[model samples]
Target: MIEVEGVKIDTRHWIGGERVASTRSFPDISPIDERHLGDLDAAGAAEVDQAVTAARAAFPAWAALGPTGRGAILRRVADGIDERREDLARVETRDNGSLLRSHRRGVMPRVAMNFRFFADYAEKLAHPGMEVRGHRERITYDPAGVTAIITPWNAPLMLATWRIGPALAAGNTVVLKPPEWAPLTASLLADIAHEAGLPAGVLNVVQGTGAEAGAPLTRHPGINRLSFTGSVPTAGVIAAAAAPNVVPLSFELGGKSPLLIFADADLDLAVDLAVEQFDNAGQVCLGAFRLLVQEPIAEEFTARVVERARALVQGDPRDERTDVSALISRPHFERVRGFVDRALADGARALLGGGPNTSLNGLYYSPTILADARPGSEILTEEVFGPVLTVQTFADEDEGVRMANETRFGLAATLVTGSAEKAERVSEKLSAGTVWVNCFFVRDLGAPFGGNGKSGIGREGGTYSFDFYCDVKNTVFSPAGWRES
Candidate 1:
């Protein structure tokens, strides 16, 4: 255990494969009870520079390892994560306020899968050569020199792996900056990577607030590529920093995704999905914030959704029976509550819950549903990023699609329909990067994941991820026969 500023912390930053402490540190507070979990070292500009320089120095040897060699290490990393899955899951849940059950059954396993998937992909990656006339041309995919991966607090380790797995698999040295709010699991991951036989300086971690560390890291000349997952405003700031340097970027920002429920859809599944909007306290980027129901069954659908949401148990996240828990922090909880209050003042009726759960001492808010939210209302337009759902009715298929696409965000959308033809047709018309039919949040690691418009800038996962982390160069040379000529 380590202490900074009188507060005790259980973790430290990993720099050049060594544990390092920072001059300044901040307390890590648990949203579950507003308790001080520990103190996290705040990486300032100096630390950021140190991390970047280390990554840059290590890039050559790591890249020289070739895909097969890198893949072997990545596979070992996956095995390490699996070996420590239970402990890592608990750490993540305790640090970030995510349910223990989610980390155990879902998040931790996916972290391992991410490494395994990218390891296999690295081996299968090929840059085939082509013959044009008498010249032989070949395309080579080279790792982007040094990469900076900034992950969000929502799912720290899981999301970090999303970037780390691909970046390392492509042979790029990484300087990962995990969110200060939830930095524990990331620290653990660094230890696991080292144990998996990753060379010193190949992977490094910096921990601090966005202003102190993130800004300098983004602007650092040593970094060749940047991948970020967070809010749009933050993305803009990062983009500006990278602009002068022309560093390639991949951004996965916020979303106010819509879930359309057609007249002929299964009511049971629709209600289940509607309640899922409140999952993770509605902190998910791809969460369904707006519900677009066909006019004929609008009233019934809303009623069922409200009923199901009200039934969710609000208590300790560690409890197996608890369905809803505290928000990430007090400020975030208040911000989410403010959205509900403002929407209510704007004449939107609360169909179920609309206030904090006073019974709970922590930052817990009740699952809320707003009915008859006007077009362009804040509740309908802005991202609440909480357990709040806004319901609107549409008369026809075209109206449903229009209402669903009304927001500037185009990250993800869900459509439930019995008709196969209608599902395909409506999915095509939706502007979101990902469109789900009869399902919500089902992920395939190989599929392209991202958003269109204000949602984000580039895609991640599968070939898309591999392409982003690499620089594809084409080389042409004269054929043997042509050289003779």
Candidate 2:
């Protein structure tokens, strides 16, 4: 156990509202300093089954509580999260090496906001209005049974709750398989849920590798729905595993999002948005990886972005001044490094940082920017998922839209233009789930969020979330009973 903000957090599988020991365990290491934090119990098939069984048993009573009752408990969960904001942020920083300041200022608060928003949303805006002229029609949402949720490591707690809040608010019991790389916060979340009086079996967390824990959870017949946020390969594996059960799946997969900058746009704002890609050391899935700058401003904008990338401080995540920190693990660091190395080898020029930061230990890669990267090159087309951005120039509006849309992934994009007409016209053509105009990472919980193409299979947030968590049914009555009673 590790102590965070006076709370001793146990790194164990939380199933049926209790900590469960496993025959096999894995070491939880801090990416910040490479310290062995604790031995986390790795849940196997048996544990997955146990968690699923518990969720199934709790489904009826949990659903019976209905929206209002469930929302009340979720509100308390949000309060508990808010109360332990410092603790959660600290743990997350140590666990994944995200900057402590970012977590405390934004990530942790957003985690609580997710629960609070969904609780209120499920309580209020879940009903779909329908009108039928010839018959009386009513639509109702019924909670899907046990839901299996697999979250990514980059932003573990926040993403987990993004799925969890809705699943619970929709009155469905959940069995969550957190990414083994950063599983601590998920365990702590279970504690908060229990303290907030969330019933046993209503929320269960099983921690382990994707093959061991995640596969079992996805394949479990007890699960009625599955939601996953991670890589495309992992999603593919999950799909094949869940196909036998034919489990309805909602996937928020990878992205090669583009940041389109026009000449008329605010230069500083465009540079800031470009630099924003390096936030969280560029592990953000929705981050703009490919930068398509209009030719008129390409040279100046690239210079500003390169300068900012060079200035970003890299060191311990606990330091408030630090901008970049360690990658999640050695393998991931190598993966990102490989992407940059290959690009440079293939004649792409590194405008700035191109390798690991020798000044600091561990897996800290310098914020990298590549220029002259060939269009459709691996670095430009693939989801590097690092603090690496590739610069590409577009001659005109049509060219900018073309470059942005020419990708297999369509998760998100950013358009920096002063012209409202250009924003409106270009945004419509961008093949992405969400587009940010003159801003980046600003989110409204009410907006529909997901991706098109290889990015994701379905949307989440607002009614979109409810649509997946609940089985919507329409009840239609024959027109006024032709034979009077």
Candidate 3:
């Protein structure tokens, strides 16, 4: 909790291993009921600069710890997360309106697992050198000084740790700028990091609007690497800011990914997997927004999908029975509603839901399905980022693959087919960063995860993250008799 001008708020940013307050504050409202949850301190240029300076000062010592030492600290952090899992999950639910059940059972567990995976990987990591004809060369990896990590409002803690775990494991100091809408959990994470014995100034959290905090952090010359997860337009802005300093960036942006359901797919399995589009209220970057069903079974597949979507429970996010929750804010809720309204206006047919669920208060939109949506419509081509699915039909395998790859965004794609050969062939042709065969959200912690084209910039997760957060330098040692020319 924080106090500003004699008023108390529920959250505060952590910088230099201490709770910090800002002069200006922003209202933190609950999407479930629009109630005032708290006042979040607004971190601007000054705060961002302070956090970066602290990280920059802390980098040398953190890097000197070596991978094993750093891994040990990370392991403790992982354990700390597990110890506070329930508290963390509840904070996340209150901040972002994600269903408490999902947060506890799914998101929070993944957060701890991510830290543990990276910690173990860091200890086992090897940067082997080679023996050349006349010299022995050694390859080494070093942290990239200060890394500025910006995460979105959806799944705040899980996504932030996705970058935080690997960056810290590789020994880079970080300044994390969590979304203002969901800043609570990031602060909690900072507390946990400190309690786990993370060195002072090793990790900092700055909270504010994108213009004030995010833009300055991205453009700060002190930062060595920039890692961001958000929309495509925002990524472009971040890229421009980082350009002047030549700061390398790893972007995990938005997607309108496709799910290809072949004629031979198991109908039950296919429908279940496709319904994952509504998980986290469809705010997931990897959620399948475009469904391409084979023409032969398109009707049956769409019917089942609609039925399942309709059956999903929609109510208070805290309720264990609720399957779907409200959007993060009123503006975002309206924006998602606008996408559906425009689609319907442009001649798209809503097979299930199309607009806000006025029956209930707050920001709730029904799980929507638009059948026979025009290929070029806004809803079909753009990322709705809501509980909405726009579906189309493909005649055969060739057409299915073609249509799946048609979108500019290629973050993730799904192929539901019984034949292994067809799955392999189509997976190869799909231009997505990750392809799931007969699965929806099953992710391997060690696998490379990112998108191609507008979806994202670089890969993360596993050793791939180590590549982004560190610099690999080769040291050459000539034979004892050799001399420099």
- Backbone clash total, candidate 2: 0
TM-score of 3: 0.96
Q: What tens-digit string does per-residue lDDT give for candidate 2 at 163-273?
A: 999999999999999888888899889999999999999999999988788878888888999999999988999999899998999999999999999999999999988
| Model 1 spans with C-alpha error above 4 angstroms | 2-10, 127-129, 480-485
Q: What is the TM-score of each candidate against the true structure?
A: 0.97, 0.97, 0.96
Model 1 scores what on Cα lDDT? 0.89
Query: Which pairs clash in model 3?
Result: none
Candidate-wise lDDT, in order: 0.89, 0.91, 0.89
What value of lDDT does candidate 2 attain over all alpha carbons? 0.91
Better of 1 and 2 by TM-score: 2
lDDT of 1 at 310: 83
Task: List candidate 2 stretches off by more than 4 Å.
Answer: 4-7, 126-133, 479-485
Which ten-residue region of model 2 has the weakest summed lDDT?
Answer: 125-134
lDDT per residue for candidate 3 within 1-485, as digits (tens), equals 74322333346678888888899988887788887777889999999999999998899999999988988888899899999888887777877999999888888988988788998988887767798897889887788899899999998999999999999989999999999888888877887889999998999999999998999999999999899999999999999999999999999999989999999999999999889889989988999889899989999999889988899998888899999999999999999999999889888999988988878767999889998777777888899899999889999889889899888998999999999999989999999999999998778989999999899998988878888998977899987875689
Q: What is the Å distance of residue 160 in model 3 from its true position? A: 0.3
